[model samples]
Target: MTVDRDSLTELRDLARAFAAERDWGPFHTPKNLAMALTVEAAELAEHYQWLPTGADHELDERKREGIRHELADVLLYLIQLADQSGVDLRAAALEKMELNRLKYPADQVRGDARKYTEY
Candidate 1:
């Protein structure tokens, strides 16, 4: 569903309950959760690696569905990790975007694909 803080809080509580039932919270430290996020992201990327470049829309329907599910898995784990780590993920993401905007101003990057240093 939506990925707002309220929704993330709900998802985190659910994850807490699920982990508590199996006593798995101890294994979900910030480091491990970060690692899990990376692993899951890689798995999601693997789904499209074999497809022709720029043909993402032409993939098999089932493959597209699978990719969507994997993307959700990555997002869920990210939400859970941010929750457990006390990180305001939305704010952090926004702050990064702001920094990127300064680094690559739209006027310079509107049609230029050069690296930030090239500008």
Candidate 2:
């Protein structure tokens, strides 16, 4: 699904509902959620850990689906943590992008993989 605010809201609601149904709300604090998000991210990374660079493009359908599910899990936890913490994720993301733009101006950084500080 698209990563717009409306879609994120929908996913957030679904996540909240899923947790509510299982009485997991008490354990869904920001810290716990953040940790879970990190774990899920690690799990997602595992799918590509041993692959050579560019090998991700060769993943078959099943591996792709596995990655998709891990991504979804990471997103769900992030949405949940953002919701619980009263964060406006879209705005924060846009603001961060603007900061990155200043740090890595296109004309100077194009085709360069170096850190902004290195340049």
Candidate 3:
């Protein structure tokens, strides 16, 4: 299947097919997927761990490529986790964004970094 960068559904389908092909569904329990997702996210964060503030702005091509691959790993595991848990990943993201808008209203939280409770 064609994997379009814009399509979360396609990514989720691909991840499902990949696990099915490997008979890995049994191993992809929600807990396992969540742990794996966290590991991958840490790996992604590792790329920037030692960088000075704003150093990411100067990432060389090799560093950028490494970051891209790590990001993909994090995303794939997230999609798999959402799939195994019967969540529509895209819809959840949209829903979370709406919640964020309510919690951090633009007029009140504009230019602020504090939590909603702090305001």
Candidate 4:
């Protein structure tokens, strides 16, 4: 999933509207958004807690839907946090991917699971 800039912008606007409609702007400080994002991420992780390494690929429809909802929650919170913090999520992700490519060069790290520092 590559989400375009327009989609991210739409998500950000939706998140902003949701917060505003609920009079949540005052409570949506960067710290609070970050904490909420972490919580949502944990919730998403919980859905896969006891699954086998490749179990996700075999999820039943109901379980897949549950995972989908959890993923949505995680994404929504992340979008809200990024919007509140004035961070461009798409750009940051791309930049980080570039940095990761440098850190974990394919030829050296191929089929390896060690940290970059270990290489």
Candidate 5:
């Protein structure tokens, strides 16, 4: 909760400039950015695709670097999508966490993985 808001703003500005510099604004639609974000997420997941449970802890430096880049790609696309959609990503995330807390109270859902509506 102590996160600096300006840092996020900077990142958002960076995403905007990145697209603008590449003359990619026309392609940076919310839909396109969303799809790109999903693709980056899938690439990130590919690292763990066939790994056993503890495999996450055992990744080598090279694989870790690749995962880092994939995560950055996902983050950049996400910022761009939010910028295009006029959504405040950090605020939305905080709000969602509050909503989830109400939906899945720790007292009621502790150790449970089912959807809140199911329980």
Candidate 6:
């Protein structure tokens, strides 16, 4: 699926406007926002701590739904953080991947689980 930049910008604006309306910007400084993202990510991970990674094998539907919601919350916070920081996550990710490719060449690292230097 493709995301439209304008829509994302609009969404971020709406989120910021809502937060400002409630006087929440003071709580949304970079450090606080980063900590909040980490907490939400931990909440997402807590759901699957000892559970199987497959979808169809889960026993409880409610647990699965809760996990999905928590994951979404984590992603929302991440998107907000990126928006606030003026970072293009996709571009950054691709740039990092290029660096990783140079550090971990496929011929040496493919099918190996060792560190880059070991490879």
TM-score of candidate 3 on Cα atoms, chains taken together: 0.89
lDDT, candidate 1, equals 0.85
Report per-prediction Cα RMSD to one decimal: 3.6, 3.6, 3.0, 3.8, 3.3, 3.7
- In the predicted model 1, the residue pairs found to clash are none
Compared with the true structure, all predictions reach lDDT values of: 0.85, 0.90, 0.88, 0.86, 0.88, 0.78
- For model 3, residues 12-41, the per-residue Cα lDDT tens digits are 879889989999999999999999999999
Q: What's model 5's overall lDDT?
A: 0.88
Q: Give each model a TM-score.
A: 0.82, 0.90, 0.89, 0.88, 0.90, 0.75
Alpha-carbon runs more than 4 Å astray in model 4: 1-5
Candidate 3 accuracy as lDDT = 0.88
Candidate 3 deviant stretches above 4 angstroms: 1-6, 54-56
Give one digit per residue, the lDDT tens place, for model 6 in 8-117. Answer: 56667787887889998778776777888999988877877787674657648877797889887776677678866888766777899999999998987889998887
Model 3 poorest 10 in a row by lDDT: 49-58
* Higher-TM-score candidate of 1 and 3: 3
Q: How many residue pairs clash in each candidate?
A: 0, 0, 0, 0, 0, 0
> lDDT tens string, model 2, 30-58?
99999999999999988887678627677
- Candidate 4 at 88: error in angstroms? 0.8
Assess candidate 4 and give its lDDT. 0.86
- Model 2 error, position 51 (Å): 0.7
**Residue 72 displacement in candidate 6 (angstroms):** 1.4
Worst 10 residues of 1 by lDDT: 2-11
lDDT of 6: 0.78
Colliding residue pairs in candidate 6: none
lDDT of 4 at 103: 96
> What lDDT score goes with residue 36 in model 4?
82
Output the better candidate (2/6) by lDDT: 2
Q: What is the per-residue lDDT of model 4 for residues 25-97, given as tens digits with 9 covering 90 to 100? A: 9998889888887888887777777778628586778778887988898898888888878899999999999
